[model samples]
Target: MAETLRIALAQINPHVGDIRGNAERIRRARAEAARLGADLLVTPEFSIGGYPPEDLVLKPSFNADAAAAIEALAAETADGGPGVVLGGPWVAEGKRHNGLFVLDGGKIIARRAKHELPNYGVFDEKRVFEPGPAPGPVAFRGFRLGLMICEDWWFPTVSETLAESGAEVLISINGSPFEVGKAQLRIDLAVPRVVETGLGFVFLGQVCGQDELVFEGASFVLNPDRSLAVQMPLFEEAITLTEWTRRDGRLVCTPQKLAPIPSAEEQVYRAMMLGLRDYVNKNRFPGVVLGLSGGIDSAISAAVAADALGPDRVRAVMMPSPYTSRESLEDAAACAELLGIRYETIGIGPAMEAFGAMLAPAFGNRAPDITEENIQSRARGLTLMALSNKFGDMVLTTGNKSEMSVGYATLYGDMCGGYSVLKDIYKTLVFRLCRWRNAHVPAGSLGPAGPVMPERVITKPPSAELKPDQTDQDTLPPYEVLDAILEGLVEGERGVEALVAEGHDRATVLRVWRMLDRAEYKRRQAPPGVKIGPRAFGRDRRYPITNGYTNLIA
Candidate 1:
């Protein structure tokens, strides 16, 4: 019987549906683990096919290919190297499962399926996978290693069952997505399991951007005494070997260096950078182009793109109209210069004039109102789309959550883009991130070290600049109030009376709620962006567009 074990945690990034590519990543990690003299190498959930394969796993061919990859990986373990714990889609007894397989000695030894299938918010695991029954520990090198997949460890029952079944150490493989404050939350959730079972715990999380989801990878270990033994870095790929020894009949993890947790601002910024970088590269877009309007939203959007994809791949265009202020033009050019990206000025005056002339006869003698303003916005959208078609750059939209929440944006205008970096970020947080980026460059940033935008851009009032003397405040309440109300309605899910009791005006709260409901259709068509908070639009928060339930006061 073995008294010691060395386990290597592989924090890797896997592309969804890229079975062979993912297999190669695992093999590479295993080779490193072998060099580190580890007994077993553990990877994240669905490391073979990527997590949330979302309906892609339903196809028979995909499952077959995944199975073939798993078999090939299993066969490679015959060389007396470290055993591998891999997760992927598996079909057994005419049922599909989120399966975790143990590969050693040129064969599959033990197989465990995920029991707790997450079905809320960003996860719909129950829609595609059949939950496995309560799992027991798998024997490895004389130690009974308790294994859980992702959500299984969230509840105490699964860990208790494994403990009752004579499990020694607990390990969980996860594809958990990142949200503000989630890294700490994982530790809070895992500490309880360790306390209940009195077993050391190892958590391995996937690190990569898959669609709108970005897994932060901050995988960690908790000793049997509920002390942190190791913490991997966030938002990057890493491989760390954790040593374990049986002390007093229980496995205990040796202490390792802990990576410092980043502040919330840095976490959100890195999430945006990683999310945009992967979306563009994985989708095979050559680059990104966005309108630099000298506003905080566009300015910060461009800054994030430049930092994420590098300045060379980001193109900034200044589209000026009759209402475009000279200060805006200068600020936009200054921002482009600071980021060192390709910059050009494109005047939309001609397009606006042409649209005006064409629609003049149809509205004979009707004084121009918002229709003229909308035409200007559509003209800019057309210009950006044209550039996108001419070159291969995807249009990056610059609308923040505040504007999108109140329907304050023009759909085909500023909302026109392939992706948004600020979609989940509220207006108030946008200002904070811009300041944060200026002061510190993130670890993997590709942009400049200094400020990415002019200081005035953050201080100046925000505007769409579609009409004369137009500020965002012209149509909406102050951002501080709007953002507070939105936090209550969107994130807190508070009722109107509750918000009013908290000192918000009753009428303003109801007005914001109405605007939020009315904007659902626009949000439905908006592009996917990095999800930084819990209630990001699209999958996280779903509301019926056509609803009759209004919170009316008597």
Candidate 2:
């Protein structure tokens, strides 16, 4: 008996709250599967409401919309064609669940809720919805299948039960967002489940970018011995089918090796590029514009913008004040020229002087301090805002994570941008990225040849050029110390006492904590950007704006 099961993986991307579009996407995938003579097809987790719908899942209207869409998708298989397993929101007994709908013969055959809802590190599944009970096996065409949702596949008890119940294969539908090295880890994690259960395993994934997260779509099928049978490409969408022949009353497959994965920097850069491009293109922005200082942060951001939107679409303005050095001008010009993007220099000295003159009388009693220095930054911000208004271009904010953490950034000044592309990257990582860009231009770097970031920009003392002799280290701790403390305090959620107990100076730890806490208001006001770290200073980690409890500076 020559019997082969043709299963298709629909590596499609879905937008949050766009249920109709997502449902249409699933329909198209089903149609393709039927045409290709596929017996089954699966989409990634939350493909209907989109992965990480975040707070939108709370809205009753959105939930209702998702339910209706799910019914529509289920009704799609009415012709007894290729069966479909797709992600969508399903609520039962007044409780919401991150669910996968298994549709067959024009009706929903079975529903599986994600049991292991991740709560830590960029996940808040606990706050939003209750976890569902462990899933059982799904019967399909003379086979008992062990089906797991995105997070459920991480564990064994649920899948093991399905295997014990005589499951021929294990299938995992995932909306698993791609981080720096998550793809390899996901593959490694899937292998154990496959080998242990002695069953063929398939992982169907979503592709493209949504907000800060990017789905790599590295879908793969694994043999019973924990080896790859087939694999898909990264960061691209495709519908692929794997043929499995049943032998000895169990599914059998051949194993193959996946290609080499990209480096961390390469992954990060590509994610940002895809994220920025999709955000701009999907939102219908004509082009992107940014303020380019001679600093490495702006240099890197501009390069990314150029690479993402193309040099012709990336316009950069060098807004220099009196504090801005000639060397800065030279470097900024060089970097922009290297990228071959449109560059314009706008002098903010006159406007800054005007603002200073206007505020002189009001500030006569107070000593000239950060307030006045901030006036310069605001002046530059106003200029950029005016330019953005005059020409329809989205301004890219160049603030990095370190500055965002400690209120080192100026509000409405450098923060005046539609998106913060590198807001999640730390200062230490910024240096590494500059070096990385020089060594190898990833997908987002504008130039193919040499260093886009000037050596002086990377090697020079970090400065805001706010005053004549202002350096970042003059006010804040070294980047290594700062990043370590931030990781402990923010991501690790360690208290100040615990941080100090871990070989950290109490005073230094306290100082960093205080700075981070006080800067909460500024981060709250900042624009949304791509989140790289586990707990980015965005919706992932929410703290009160009004709080006097400082960890250090009393």
TM-score of each: 0.99, 0.90
Q: In angstroms, how far off is 520's CA in candidate 2?
A: 2.0
RMSD of candidate 2 to the true fold?
A: 3.1
Give me the runs in candidate 1 sitting further than 4 Å from their true place: 552-554
* Per-candidate alpha-carbon RMSD to the true structure: 1.1, 3.1
What's the number of clashes in each of the models?
Answer: 0, 2
lDDT of 2 by residue, 257-366 (tens): 56457778877777778778777876778888888898899998987887778888888889887788888899999988888889999988888778878988877887
Candidate 1 lDDT by residue in tens digits, 290-343? 999988899899989988999999999999998999999999999999999999
Sequence-dependent TM-score of model 2: 0.90
lDDT of 2: 0.82
